[model samples]
Target: MNDQSEQERWNARYADDSYLFGTSPNAFLASQRHLLASGQRALAVADGEGRNGVWLAEQRLHVTAVDFSPAALAKARRLAESRGVEVSFVQADLATWEWKESSFDVVAAIFIQFADPPLREAIFQGIRRTLAPGGLLLLQGYRPEQIQYGTGGPPHAENMYTAAMLREAFRGFEMVSLVEHDSVIQEGAGHHGVSALVDLVARKRA
Candidate 1:
């Protein structure tokens, strides 16, 4: 699907009363919170329903939450308010969004699956360009092997991620941590139970 169609689909998915991915930060991100630089600007891409973004804002980082779904952004705003934190919500297609170069201290991308290889590259390059020197990129997504688990994630194995793919995606950056492992994720109904995934923490070179 094109960006517009994808946005519509997500918007509809989030229009319901149920929280699609729950109202908490992803387990992997929460685990690595200490590695995040304090008091720095951060961007959460495809931050549907604002769980992760709100969590980051609570940690005192200036946060910009970007997602294509207005419904999701609305819920994200509500979440930030309830958490007594502030976050900027931007509605735009990441594929065509005008990202400012070297603008963020951290970029958080969790479970934003991009099956299109070229778009994935563009998104990764955008993440690299949008980070300040020595900035961090925290990424987590299901591995292709996740198909067997059927706990969550995109149906197409091609949309899944691998360590090698992430290594190439941030080829020039310093990889602080990279691993493919199994973990029991609990993030509401959409994402829960045991799953195989890839997690990476790469820093932009100074």
Candidate 2:
């Protein structure tokens, strides 16, 4: 889809008054508290409605949250304000987002399974290129098995992640943790049910 159409699609998905996903940090992300610290420059990729971004800000990190939908971003701004946190919210399609090299100390990518293979590769590479040396990446997403659950994420199997796929994509990074499991998650109407999940925590080599 073109940028405008993609924007419209996401805007429509987020047009509801309620947050599609809940206003809580993804469980996988919140579990990695040991790696987070005050004053880190964090990027929350595709941070719909600012849950993770606002949580990052609450942790004292300087956060930049990016999403394509204006509706989602508007809700994100309100969420940030309500939480008494400050997050720099940017509306831009990830397909064409200009990712500055070595720009962020931490990157949080939670349930961003909206892309097909080509765009996914670009985003994977972008994450690698934009992370500063020794920076941490906290990523979680559905595995192919999630198609059976149908609780959240796109139905495309190719859009799902595998541990091997992620390891190879982030090969040069120091793998701090990588796990695959099935769990029951409740994050709102968007993601609620048994889920086939994969989590990856990697640190860029200094």
Candidate 3:
């Protein structure tokens, strides 16, 4: 889809008053509290409704949340305000967003499975280029098995993640950790049920 169509599709998904993905941070992200510290510069990619970005701000990280949907960004702003946290909300298409180099200390990419193979590759490259030396990349996504489960994420199996895919995508990263598993997750109406998931935590070399 074109940029406008993509934005329209997501805006429609987020048009409702309620958050599609709920207000809490992703489970994998929240579990990595040990890696977070005050004053770190963080980027929350495709941070719809600000849940992850706001949580990062609450952790005292300077956060910049980027999404393509204006509707979602509006809700995110309200969420951040209500939570008494500050997050820089930017509405930009990730496919074209300037992924500044060596800018962020931590990059959180949770459940961003909208991209097809080509766009996914761009995003993977963007994440690598944007991270500062020794930076942390915390990402989680549904695996191909999720298609059978009929849970969250795109129906296209190509959009799903695998350990091998992630390892190759972030090839030069330190590969802090990577795992695949099945779990029942309830993250609002968007993601709920026994799901196939993969989690990756990689760090840039200093």
Per-residue lDDT tens digits for candidate 1, residues 123-186, read 8889989999999999999998889998888787888899998998899999999999998998
| C-alpha TM-scores of all predictions | 0.96, 0.98, 0.98
What's the CA error at residue 41 for candidate 3, in Å?
0.3
Model 1 regions more than 4 Å off: 2-4
Candidate 3's C-alpha runs over 4 A off are: none
Candidate 2 lDDT, tens digit per residue, 10-108? 899999999989999999999998789999999999999899999999999999999988999999999999999899999888988999999999999
Error of 2 at 12 (Å): 1.2
Model 1's number of clashes is 0
Instruction: Evaluate model 1: give its lDDT.
Output: 0.89
| Error of model 1, residue 21, in angstroms | 1.1
Query: RMSD to native for every prediction?
Result: 1.2, 0.7, 0.7
Clashing pairs in 2: none
lDDT head-to-head 1 vs 3, winner: 3
lDDT (Cα atoms) of all candidates against the true structure: 0.89, 0.95, 0.95
Instruction: For residues 98-192, write the lDDT of model 3, one tens digit per residue.
Output: 99999999999999999889999999999999999999999999999999999788899999999999999888899999999999998999999
